[model samples]
Target: MEQTPLEIQLKTLPESPGVYQFFDREGKMLYVGKAKSLKKRVSSYFNKRLENGKTRVLVGKIDSIRHIVVRTESDALLLENNLIKEHQPRYNILLRDDKTYPWLCIKNERFPRIFPTRKRIEDGSEYFGPYTQMRTVRALLDLIRSVYPLRTCNYDLSEEKVAAGKYKKCLEYHLGNCLAPCEGLQDEASYHNQVDDIREIIKGNFGASLTYFRHRMKELAVEMAFEQAQAIKEKIEILENYQAKSTVVNPKIDQVDVFSIVSDPTHAYVNFMQVSHGLVVRSHTMEIKKKLEEADADLLPLAILELRERFNSDTRELYLPFPVSLPEDLKVVVPQKGDKRKLVEFSERNARFYRQDRFKQIRIIDPDRHVKRLMQQMKTDLRLSEEPRHIECFDNSNIQGSNPVAACVVFRDGKPAKKEYRHFNIKTVEGPDDFASMTEVVHRRYRRLLQEGESLPQLIVIDGGKGQLSAALKSLDELSLRGTIAIIGIAKRLEEIYFPGDPIPLYLDKKSETLRVIQQLRNEAHRFGITHHRNRRSKSAISSVLEGIDGIGEKTARDLLRKFKSVKRIRQASVDDLAEVVGPSRARKVYESLRE
Candidate 1:
């Protein structure tokens, strides 16, 4: 027995942390993964009996193996993340949410101003969150305004200008929203103290600001300033109300980042929440597309790094639903019970809802993309060489031996191309022969296309079982197109898909988009064929009834039909009315035939 290339590579793999890649025979990357021990991890794919069906398929496609040795597990993790993102290997999890969330920033200036922003600059500014919901940011800002009076002007408030009275009090001051720092009514020390308290509040530490307000209210009451005391009392109440509404966990479990993940077969949704003083100050959910089959352990760390950098978060501790490998400097905890556990669960709920909302939005807004994805899925599931962007389905319709017709319905990008639909009268087929009808229509369709140099569909679907499928193949063989285009037959009973030269049928999941599109194609073809068949049968009946009269010719029968519209109407018309259209001699014959 000869040793294979994979076995040879496995024997030489170093017992160290590294990243590995698998390639199929055609040099396409199949999967990319990281390993703490290259020898053990790389060997496990072949050494163990894989349980996952997709994993088994991936392994079966592996024609070559490659590995890159790294210094440590963290380095391996980073290398794996970068490779998966760059190559988008068929087996890695890729985050699809590319939109950056908004953050609340306190500008680095005298009398600092706070606002929501999407971009982060290197300038000296304090940013609080990359919150998913802009409404939450707006509500927080509104709450802050109710408690503290802050300037809203864009002014260079230098000491010399204020001392020189270069600027006067603005509307902000008149409206009691500012203390007029430009006019020197607001001292630098006093303004800095208020900005500091706001910074703490934004960080989810409300105790300091609340304590200061309570003490000031008491001082105002002692000095017998009743009005100012009541004002201060309202500020305290506002701050307390915000704190009560924001806090969701034990106050002791503060200054931590929380993450939870929910995944489907093709994508993963991750929710991140920043906890400060047990309050969820920032919350966001990101959707990640899976390339190969990356798990939560692979996706969560990358999301953590991205979110923390985006939000300017420096929290040292993280609360996660599961343990993950990360840098030694950051602590990861999986809470079992109490408030921390509830916080994790809350984050998971957010992820689940976000996934559902995203699905609905995609179906409504980007229907083309959704359809394209469905076509791609069908391409993969059916093992077609290309996406079925343009598909044609054939169905035969007949009643006993009276009228035989076949309809070819064209679908472009998973939508009905109504104008391109064609109907055939089944000229060569006799009786109610479905296989012969399918053969005639398939041959005539592509033969004309070949003659006119028109493009052929990527796929052809036949609405019947193996007998009809074999008949279709016979026509393809005559046109020398046996293998040029993909063709499949779908049985009406079980919806089994039959391929040329294959006996076993492919049964797609009932709820799969691929199956739905195929069913749509089948149903459309049947409807089109049935409609044409009914019209043809009606026309034949009218021709037989009208032409069989003694004095009527084809032209006279046509004229009568043209005037009366239908056979039933022509029969109902009186001889005088018919004479006005077809003359009295032919009219009497038609009238007597109707009477007979």
Candidate 2:
């Protein structure tokens, strides 16, 4: 709730990129919002009486307000994502996309194979099609088999059929699902040609391939090779199937996204759906808290731009957050007729439902309270030019002797600075010396930023107090980068803060919420950096064993390690199973070498 008399509050807020909070009486948070031009957007709320139910409820509790100006909308979006996650404000219609989309995976090997999966694996396989629909994935797999049935079984060829002969042809081959080239029933020369055809179809040049295949079909028939001609016909049919589905997409659109916004006075719910390659992939929601008395002309463009930034756009499309007069660059689409217009009504309804159903829990929190008190103590204790506006935090994570990763998260004006968040793979630091790790990350992060001519943070937050702080400070000093950045290390328990050159942890005034907020940012950065490091470490530990095995060169080791992520799992596999993965008859040797 904007606490101040609406007019005065509007004047007080600056017109810049930043986040603002509305508070009710008792200093409780009523709502939170970010904007490119705070003055314009915040002022608009006070100027007009919100007829929207949501706004009315939020406005009724107006009390006090605060603002934190930022640099860009990208920076603003990052802050918004982090805030929404941390606060879970009642009024925000959050889009929690826990559902990882399914995609097609083609194992990268001497003879690569294609398939579908919902889980993402960091393996030596080429992955494609994070297609939103399961049906879309299945359809492609079915088409691949019908058109050019490649191996679909996850079998150990060494134990299954390789021992019988170099190539005895599997069941699919005898059944005509496969070309039987393995058994030499179908010549390798001819089978390679079929593989070429399959590759072309997957690449989306179906029409040209279909035409070329048609000629092949006719030629086969002229030679009285009826079976070969029939195979060609099947491939053509698969191509046609894909085209028919894509035909539903309105040609006039090329590609487009339809969005609608339904908001009450307190919070605005922007509901959106995207259309690509003539199909709808997903729908998402953007939540904005009640506006303050500042102006708003920049909100619409920023919202749409953020939406665009989050998704892919290799295919041209329009992403509308409302029934907007499409901008010139947006391809200004007004679907007056046909299939395109029909979609508009459905999108519009989602918009309406989204608007009305945006039941949000609004809490106005003044982070400034905690941050200000902490800054004051720091000022009196060590003294500074001003309260820190931008604080950069660093942490390192890794398993014992494994893949190590580091993360740097920034907080600007008490809000997260996402555009500046960075990750690093631990290098040069041999063992898990937490100090050395922090030093490496700090050095790498700052050196690169300076080289790139990026803005430096006003303050630095190290995850640990004392030792970690000393390591980071010393690292910066060695690089001649220490003085400008105000350094502080936050101790976890009791939330103690240790500033540079101080052995004792500093305690801040209890009333300052900004201090607590900064501590939270530092802790979160530590958590994030460690989780990434652990994941990399686990993968590295698994990858290392393959390299140690004799005869397993980089590519081969990568292929095996990728297929089975860990050495323990591979160790449990029988010789036959191992052989099947790499080739025929090598499983015994592989098993022996890996065990050694």
- TM-score for each candidate, following the candidate numbering: 0.47, 0.35
Candidate 1 residue-wise lDDT, 426-449, digit = tens: 898768888888889999999999
Ten residues in a row with the worst lDDT in model 1?
A: 243-252
Q: Cα miss at 230, model 1 (Å)? A: 71
- What is the lDDT, from 0 to 100, of the residue 68 in candidate 1? 53
Question: How does model 2 fare in lDDT?
Answer: 0.63
Off by over 4 Å in 2: 1-383, 398-405, 561-588, 591-596
Full-model lDDT for every candidate: 0.81, 0.63
RMSD of each: 20.5, 30.0
Clashes of 1: 6
Candidate 2's TM-score reads 0.35
